[model samples]
Target: MSQLATRPPLILTLRMDSQSQEFFNAFRKTYFPPERNYLDAHLTLFHHLNDNDQTLATVKSIAQPAFTLKTTGMKFLGAGVAFAIESKELHNIRKELAIQLHEQLIPQDKQGYRPHITIQNKVSPEAAKQLLNELQSTFQPITITARGLDLWQYLGGPWKHHAYHALGPAPG
Candidate 1:
């Protein structure tokens, strides 16, 4: 069987509104190393979930309304940089999912949720620090809309879109 035929781990992320997505993507494209930038900007909720029908069903069961979150600050990630986000609603949603997929949660996923959208990674620490400083110099908190949950199949470095369940609507 081909490698892809076997189930791969799943990734869950929040889908942002178009404007917010574009804003993040722009920064990601401009700052991230071109060769290593496989996916667009994302706020990962669950880093890894079992790739199975049960997991899919649980994800499909989530019903959340569109909500807003704010980017409060820039986080320097040693070798990368991210925009820190704050939202009670986002936390609640992930907590609920964590409960449902408790056994399947990996250590990283089980760790405390610190929501952030990484725009630059795989660079030197010095570079990351410089970018962090540049961004923070004129940083203004941005309010962005979270529109839905998006499920993806992890394909090594790159990912393949699996499904998207819009907030404020029954799972279709």
Candidate 2:
């Protein structure tokens, strides 16, 4: 196999700006101090596309204009913590994009469609519940706009500082 063939293809994602960044930073410090080096703020679209070139082309063709995303609630996934979006439109957009990418360019697993931005990973179940309780007590809704989509790669480290490339604007 060729070099390109050996590597997994990933879809682009959009990143959060300064204010959101600051909020996440503070949240991390308060609730997840151990998760250091986490840098870029983003939401993932697709990963491991079978054909990257085709996928990119297809993505560009269907991408929508940028829009706002409001953070409405919080949840925990095993040891992971994340904030949820208030807008159903945002959720639907993500799901639809994922579906489009999977159906057209590559096949995706059915169970991979949960919409969330992970804050931390690898915690005990009890700790996760405690963290959730703490978050619920201190929770405040944050609204943010989605400017674009980005393509990220796994650089073999903690998720906080993963290297990423912006693909393009999202389709409306």
Candidate 3:
């Protein structure tokens, strides 16, 4: 079998609303190192899932409802900065997935799951901190609707689009 066929495509992320997308997109473009900027801004859900039917099955079973993630604040990530997010429901879904994929979960995936959208990465600490300060100064409470679950194949740095499942419907 070919190497590509044997390797399970990994990397799943959460899809967000359009407004939040525009905001994060602008920030990422302006702050994130130009060289490392490849894909659009996104919030990750599960990272590094073993490529298999089981993985899809587990995702299909998630009952987590669509919700909004309030942008808590900006976090300094040593070499990057991210907009912290808080979503208990989303976390629970990820937790459930972890349990289902426990045996085959990779080391990194085994660690605690933190939901955040990185606006800047692979930059100097000074650069990160400066941007954090700038963001904090003008930061306002932004609610991004966690619309759906998106699946992707990790292509080293950039991710290739794969599949998406939107939540059924928001309670009336």
Give every collision pair in model 1.
Answer: none
> For residues 1-172, could you state the per-residue lDDT of candidate 3 as single tens digits?
8665777567878888888899899989988888999989988776788777788778778776688789898999999999999988788878888899888778888888778899999989998899899989998878888788888988888888877778766666
Strongest candidate by TM-score:
1
* TM-scores vs. true structure, each candidate: 0.94, 0.74, 0.93
Q: For model 3, which pairs clash?
A: none
Residues 1-172, candidate 2: write the lDDT tens digits. 7887775445455566667777776766565536553544356555444445655555555445556677767788787677766556556656776666656444453454555566655777788788888887988887776654555454454332223333246565
Compared with the true structure, the alpha-carbon lDDT of candidate 1 equals 0.92
After superposition on all C-alphas, the RMSD of every candidate to the true structure, in Å, is: 3.1, 4.1, 1.7
lDDT of 1 by residue, 1-172 (tens): 9564488899999999999999999999999999999899999999988888778888889878788999999999999999999999999999999999999999999999999999999999999999999999989999998888899999899999998888883234
Q: Could you tell me how far off, in angstroms, the CA of residue 170 lies in candidate 1 after the best superposition?
A: 14
Q: In model 1, which range of ten residues has the least summed lDDT?
A: 163-172
